[model samples]
Target: MFLRRLLPLSRRLFSSNSSNDPASIIAELNKEMESVFGEPPSSTHPNSIDNNVMAAQDSQSVSPKIVENDYGLTHVGSKGEAQMVDVSPKENTKRVAVATCKVILGRKVFDLVSANQMAKGNVLSVAKIAGINGAKQTSNLIPLCHNIKLTHVRVDLSLNRNDCSVEIEGEAASTGKTGVEMEAMTAVSVAGLTVYDMCKAASKDIQITDVRLEHKSGGKSGDWSREE
Candidate 1:
């Protein structure tokens, strides 16, 4: 809870050679922490704890008992209560995320969308516009989501005549402190829902499934892509 930052020693903490003398490493860390926040309990003997044990303890404790809360569930408090994470300290980074969803149109619905003969109008076009709007209004739709200005949002919907299905892909880009995975996913989901709404008259049982984040890039953590 305190602002006693020791970011200067972040690299040292993780890079320390535990194979040579893990106990010594933890002891050194304990000494440094003691200087900042006082000593540990007399019952906690040095030999009783090691790197992994200390890490678990540090991850769970979050108050005067802890000098540095390295990592944990950011959206939850130490007491397991819900709370928003403070992302202000993190540097702004260009963030991009891509998500995909599949809408399996029944025979009648597929014909309507593929032929652009839906009674509600151009099903794919309306879904595209709805997806863009969904990306922009992500913070409003989801609880505890930050309001971020997206630099770009692209929603693409393609119909596959072979399988009578539509594939929806949404990509959201933002130059901010947080990734846009949620926005991308929400866009795809909303677009798929839009398709269902527009074409439900043709087939009420049209299936929408397999919505997932396909890729994410930027931010402090760097780039990541799904294996499949």
Candidate 2:
């Protein structure tokens, strides 16, 4: 929720609902900046090649040097500083990411949901809408994420009788400098949460599990897909 959207006086009214507070928005933007620029190439070394053997080796292989920024802590700098990644130099490309989640429910609850028999109405229908809304709200919720123009967002929900569960999948696509993995994951999260919130009346034992990125494509790192 964004204050700009919540307290909109003009055309930008009520945008980014997840960032409803001003202080939070500033903090989020600052955090994102720190994450983006936290790392730089520590050093550049020319490679020596043996023409005959066609071998190449790094000249600065052993000297103590600043290590590359770890993905686990992209927000922290080599010197323990925070920075915003400069995306101006990055080329915009079509990026897509998919995430999945499973919601396990009791037999009674599962049957009720699959048949849309719950008093709360169509669970999957509401969840799909919630998932899309969640994807749109990802930037606002995440502290270090850019407000991306989403080209496409799709959320699928299927009742799995064999597993006594509901399978949820969310796919997000954008043509931008960064990937949309968070958006996809957020979609699945909200969809699963919606199911819990809606079906809690039926049973409180519902479990959400295996929330993870299933696939991603585009960007400099290329593509990745989870195995099983």
Candidate 3:
């Protein structure tokens, strides 16, 4: 790229070499300088990069972007570092969250599970218990999450014959500075894992999928629900 630009200027300068005046030669050299390194920028030019080292130092000195509260990443600090949020100053409010997941069992495995004929005993009952326990121990499982007292937690499982899957739903409620969204999500995830563990012997192809939060309410962000 530099050679391409320099060649054009060199051709023009050589063509004008017939004018042997000292002032004319100096003018040609200045033009070459301007062509090689772009015209000098004004000191106040907002986007100037004339002083590359100074420009880079200015970029490095720029403050980090502030994260606003429209569901921004609260776990990150102002210095662009990962950190847990401090909920000490926030008001304690009643919060509720619901999460769900699906476990796909093949036709034969689904039949066996539905009939409670698996060697693992009652799959749904055990998964439900696991989900409840998971909700209670969510803080231990996830990093940077606050351990808040939960008011209630419930796990429900339903068999979807049409899809040959078991739908697991978990709801968590708490009256604290933080919401129970993680707890609810953890509950659904653990319950799905429990289902997979108990049924893996019968079918290795069993899949757990579509784990998501379906609803949440009673927080500074207000309420939100997934559109059906």
Candidate 4:
């Protein structure tokens, strides 16, 4: 490719023979090239090609920006592979997270659960237990979650007559290098699932929705909360 592009310019420069000065010849050659090719191609010479390749390799050598947040999937290695985060270097600190979810049970199932008439037993009590257990076992459930000792776990369930749903709130606290966001979320999720399992007999149309972290505190990123 280099030879093909250079052949025309070489013929035109030597044919002119107007000046034997190497500097002037080189400058004319460059002007002719720009007129014919508009821009220099990367394959102009072996050294230019090597320089471009080196520049690309240098860019790849730089560590990529990795953002850890609710909108991004983290826990990645240098080679873009999945890997667990290492928090061993971090200092232990108190962390707290709150998560919430809602289980839509319809009017009939909601009333039954509210009145403690479900055949599977008291829905709220069993779900609360399940939520606490789930918070403790968060590391086992999530592949990349750290197994930190939880200081406390609380699960609250309330009947929402307006929506005919059970609102579940889970709170988890820990003194560890990593935050307990996943644990709190796991608690709310498990509680919602237990609510469905206990009341599925009454209505299979039950839905679990709005599972999300409401607030998190005491991390390197500081604190965060949902906007209303």
Candidate number achieving the greatest TM-score relative to the actual structure:
3
TM-score of 3: 0.74
The positional error of residue 174 in candidate 2, measured at the CA in angstroms, is 0.4
Better of 1 and 3 by lDDT: 3
Candidate 2 vs candidate 3, TM-score winner:
3
Native-to-model Cα distance after best TM-score fit, residue 38 in candidate 4, in Å: 19
lDDT of each: 0.87, 0.85, 0.90, 0.91
lDDT of 3 by residue, 63-129 (tens): 4463333346888666656788998998989999999999999899899999999898899999999
Candidate 2 per-residue lDDT over residues 21-46, each given as its tens digit: 87867665655544556544446433
In model 4, how many backbone clashes occur?
0
What tens digits encode model 1's per-residue C-alpha lDDT throughout 77-138?
66666787789998999999999999999777888788899899999999999999999999
Collision pairs in model 3? none
Q: In model 1, which runs have C-alpha deviations exceeding 4 angstroms? A: 1-71
Lowest summed lDDT across 10 adjacent residues in model 4 is found at 63-72
Task: Write the candidate numbers in order of decreasing TM-score.
Answer: 3, 4, 1, 2
Q: How many angstroms is residue 149 displaced in model 2 relative to the true structure, after the best TM-score fit?
A: 0.6
The global Cα lDDT (0 to 1) of model 4 is: 0.91
